[model samples]
Target: MAARRKPALICCGAALAAAVVLAAVFTALYFTVLRPRPPRVTATVVGTRVSAFALIPSPALNLTFDVAVAAYNPNRAAFEYGEVVTVVRYHGDAVGEAVVPRGEVGARASAEVRAVVEVDAVEVFSSPYFPLEGIAGALPFETATTVAGKAVVLGVLKIRASSVVTCGVTVYPLRKETTSPQCTSTVHVG
Candidate 1:
């Protein structure tokens, strides 16, 4: 009777150990393989400064801002080559944002790149009625138009540097309201 009891206890202990191991493996899979991926870039705006200038047709609001974006590649995969897009908000209004693609990052590793964003005044109130005048028939400024009072979104930025390049973006925000020739405004970068 004693010997029979010992074998039964041993068998039970082994079964319990196997079950625990299986549970651990499943938990790891759920956290790693089954979990959602983290963002490619951790974005941060160090600082921002705006310089306003008036274009002949409208004023140009140039934004000079310092930005920092970083990421962690655990698998050590080919993530060095990725994209970084940032959206800047000021007074509840977004000034603009930019994205850096993988192609640009892979070219350089562990480097911070500088980006410049521009906001124009004329573009603020730009109207199709006032199609840009071209020497032959090419109106470049037309494409850069923006409605007045509307938030500015600069689109995407692509860059590469040695290891990491941390720089600034000079953005031109155009507002054509003519409310003030100075066209002074506040900008929030993040």
Candidate 2:
């Protein structure tokens, strides 16, 4: 009976060792390759259109801005996002807002979103710094874009994620052009 028990004990030990090794390998792979990553977002000012500008009766300006937004997913999952919201600000006050329709980005792929922001005449003229900047031959504006969505992995696991990108741009109303934008971006996942 002792001899028979020896072989059984050896077999059980070998099985246990194999199980531990397999678990370790799988854990390492999940952390290094299968883990989900946050998507990268960026925005740029593509074009500017100044329709009306006057300071005679009062300060009034009507401007239309064309913006290009890009999103890149680095994971092996598809990212489906809700509407993209973009707000334009002058001296920390919101002057314009635009919305892009909801969309999806494939795994390891990128998408470009276009938005047309219309500036309110009242909001632009309300800023005290507007006169100074206007006289300086350039107007400064800030654009903030927020994207919220979820990443679907293997059509089963869904991870919520969001990204925000803010850009500072200088516009020459007379020239109908915008300078290179300075931008910052952040992403969150849960």
Best by TM-score: 2
Off by over 4 Å in 2: 1-11, 155-159
Best by lDDT: 2
**Model 2 error, position 48 (Å):** 1.3
Weakest 10 consecutive residues of candidate 2 by summed lDDT = 51-60
**RMSD in angstroms, all models?**
13.9, 2.5
What is the lDDT for 41 in model 2?
84
**Mind giving the per-residue lDDT tens digits that candidate 2 earns over 1-190?**
9999999999999999999999999789768866777788888878788877666686667798788989998878888899999999988999999999999999999999999999987877778887887777588999999999988776756788888889998888767677888889888889
lDDT for 153 in candidate 2 is: 70
Model 1 Cα lDDT, one tens digit per residue, 1-190: 9999999999999999999999999779756643322213333445545555444574344544445554432222222343544444332234455555544222113444444444332443253422332212212220011111111112222112122222232222342111111111222222
All candidates: TM-score: 0.34, 0.84
Per-residue error for 138 in candidate 1, Å, reads 35
User: Which stretches of candidate 1 lie above 4 Å from their native place?
Assistant: 1-9, 18-58, 72-83, 102-115, 120-190
The per-model lDDT (C-alpha) reads: 0.36, 0.86
Question: Model 1 reaches what TM-score against the true structure?
Answer: 0.34
